[model samples]
Target: MLTNDRIVLKILKNNKRRPLSAYDILDKFLRIKRIQPATVYRSLKNLLEQNLVHRINQSNKYIVSSENSHENDVTTIVVCEKCNDYEEINVNKFKMSLAYNILDLKNFDLNDFSVEISSQCKNCKT
Candidate 1:
């Protein structure tokens, strides 16, 4: 891996449980490296393109991608609004049916989609 990739990976690994924005990652790296926002964003973009990271659309944050995730699989990320915790769940079977139904109705080709649901987590609710 490249230097930027290593740095980004280290940051993600260090905060594996929660998602982080590019600014958050940049802030953390500032202590050890004199990095800029563009550098952090570039690294994050590369990681996202490579599927090493997953973006939570609702929260506008990124999390380490699960090793078990597949390129063709439809992954749904459920995030806790209160605690900011998230979990990725594969909804391939549901996605296939939903995609086909929508495509049949609209006559449009479906390429990619991401679903994010926000709710208070069990721990956060207690």
Candidate 2:
């Protein structure tokens, strides 16, 4: 891994349970190194392209990809609105079913996909 990769990875690893925006990561890194916003964004872009990180569109944040997940795998992210935590779930069977349904439409090309579900976490419910 490169220097920027290492630094960004460290920040993400430290906050693995929650998704963070680029600015959030940059703020945490500023105390340690004289880093810039572009540097953090570049590192995040690199990590995202490499599939080492996953972007949560709903929250506009990023999280470390799960250990068992691959770039091609179907991923479902469940986000807690109350706690701002997220978890990744594999839905391979559902993916296959959805793909078949889409294929039956007979003109739609299935490329890439991800699902994000938002709800209050268990702790927050209590």
Candidate 3:
């Protein structure tokens, strides 16, 4: 199941910003193999649990997970709603650690590991 999920992740990595929905993936996979949605969902769930993939909230889309810090497991994701362009914000500065500490103090689950801050891109704005 995990290996199959990685196959799905590889597909996702090749197409960033497309934000494929579950049904979309199901339909695609069904054409190649006779797998049920439940099976795919199960695998996806496991992948998510292992932090090998991520789900977009409000949108219900999936994408490959960004590599995180094993030491602190810290990462930040930036998303553009208009274009659906995503970027991984490498938290090199102290501010990221400060915010992480603050958030941990507040006790947010934040399990999915995504930061969906929406704004128009310069191209979109223009």
Candidate 4:
């Protein structure tokens, strides 16, 4: 991994709850050394390609990929809409087979599957 990629991974590992935007990473990493947005983005792309990180499409932020997440397992991201906090869960293969079964019933070819559920956290609910 590149120095910038390691820096970004460290940031993501430290930040386990809320996701961080590319600019957020750039800002944090900049305190250590000067870097640009494109650099941060490139690091992110590398991390993503390596499956070391996951992107929250809803918020355009990134988080460390769960160690439990595998290539075939489904990654379900539950985000608290109010607080913007998030959690990643790796659904077991049994659940994945069920999904495949459903899709097969429809004659849909399964490739990659991801799910994002939006809800309010306990604190936000009150």
* After superposition, candidate 1 runs with Cα above 4 Å error: 93-100, 105-108
- For model 3, give the 10-residue run with minimal summed lDDT: 68-77
Q: RMSD in angstroms, all models?
A: 2.3, 2.5, 3.5, 2.4
Instruction: Give the C-alpha lDDT of model 2.
Output: 0.82
Ranking by lDDT: 4, 2, 1, 3
Once superposed on the true structure, which residue ranges of model 2 sit more than 4 Å away at CA? 93-100, 104-108
Model 3 root mean square deviation, Cα atoms: 3.5
Which model is ahead, 3 or 4, in terms of TM-score?
A: 4
Residue 31 lDDT (model 4) = 87
Number of clashing residue pairs, candidate 1: 0
The best candidate by TM-score is 1
lDDT of the candidates, in the order given? 0.82, 0.82, 0.68, 0.84
TM-scores for every candidate against the unseen true structure = 0.85, 0.84, 0.74, 0.84
Model 2 worst lDDT window (10 residues): 91-100
Score candidate 4 by TM-score against the native: 0.84
TM-score of model number 2: 0.84
Q: How close is candidate 3 to the true structure, as a TM-score?
A: 0.74
lDDT tens readout by residue for model 1, 1-126: 349877997899899997888889999989878977899889988898887888988778889888888768777789999999988887574566576575575655557666688898999999
